[model samples]
Target: MDKAFLIQFTGSMAAVAVLVGLAAWARIGRPSPGLDEARARDLLAEDFPDRQIDQLWIAREGRGALARSGACALVLIQVGDGYAARRLSWCQASSAMFRNGQLDIRLGEVAAPRAVLAFDNWPPKDLAA
Candidate 1:
């Protein structure tokens, strides 16, 4: 192989390796738990013991100029009522952003409305709310 060609190829490979390494490093400490509805429900249950959650919705913030959206999951829990409209806010520290973050649940034409619950850092004294 020509010396110049070999050097160019090696440099390109090194650049690619650096980009991959940077990406991996950046994502290492980040939370990528797939933030699905099931996980959100589990977090809600752990956070709120007495209160029962009937429905859950997860919404991700849009990005870039085009406003590309992220993943979202809808969870339906089997409670006395089918589902209800409720407002919930999850703690930032916890990964329960699905139900915790800024979002609203609508009952619409549903027969029952799901009770909205927010999961905070510390457990509340009374689980009534």
Candidate 2:
């Protein structure tokens, strides 16, 4: 490639990097909101209109939640700057472990295979719903 072309390309790349860095510093993307019961309910309502949440548990830091709807369980987890929700039977879980006040669950999902939820208590009363 020509020297002038290389110089221009390098300058353009540097400019893009600077913009990305600034965006990151400013937190341009929507970070996960602290999920309260109402917020979680709203999100669940929007996602699963047919089901009604009978019981709900939010992670200590609002990182995730576990909700019981009818006979199934719903999981809401933070992914990147957003959240992902999944409804499944607890029996479908590949594994579950309690570590340092957090419960790690493997849901066997390709997009969101695992969720780490923190609660004040370990060995949650209801691991299955």
Candidate 3:
């Protein structure tokens, strides 16, 4: 093969490889357990039996340096019929586990709120609160 042609071919391959690597990295940087509204509601129902979930939101927060960052999906659970409100945070890893029916919520920091009676679902009962 001609030297110029070989160099050009190698350069093109390198560019394609870089592009593919970037795409994969971006995907891995995203948080897991990307649940839709219906699935989120079902998970909440199983965790918090009686309370009706009003809304659920998956919040992704990036941590660490930009090059090595990781994302976490925060499940915000909200509940209530009227003016009352409560909130709970089911961390990304925990939410994924629970969504899979593993039930591994660390109730210590992210549990039922005493003042507002929050439920354990995505967008916990009093999310707005």
* TM-score for each of the candidates: 0.29, 0.71, 0.27
Write down the lDDT of every candidate, Cα atoms only: 0.38, 0.81, 0.39
Q: Which candidate number would show the highest lDDT if scored against the true structure?
A: 2
- Expressed as tens digits, the lDDT of each residue in 66-110 for candidate 3 is 000123222333333111122334243334334431233333343
Q: For model 1, how does the per-residue alpha-carbon lDDT over 1-129 read when each residue is reduced to its tens digit?
A: 999999999999999999999999976653334445565565545545555553333434211000001222233332332222222333221223234533223333355443233333223233222
RMSD values for the candidates in order, in angstroms, are: 16.3, 4.7, 15.3
Q: What is the lDDT of residue 61 in candidate 1?
A: 25
Looking at candidate 3, the ten consecutive residues that score lowest on lDDT are 61-70
List ranges where model 2 is wrong by over 4 Å: 1-31, 91-95, 122-129
Q: Rank the candidates by lDDT, best first.
A: 2, 3, 1
State the lDDT of candidate 2 residue by residue for 1-129, as single tens digits: 999999999999999999999988887675657999999898888889999887889999997788877667789998777778988875442246877888888778787878889988754677543
RMSD of 1: 16.3
Clashing residue pair totals per candidate (backbone < 3 A): 7, 0, 11
Better of 2 and 3 by lDDT: 2
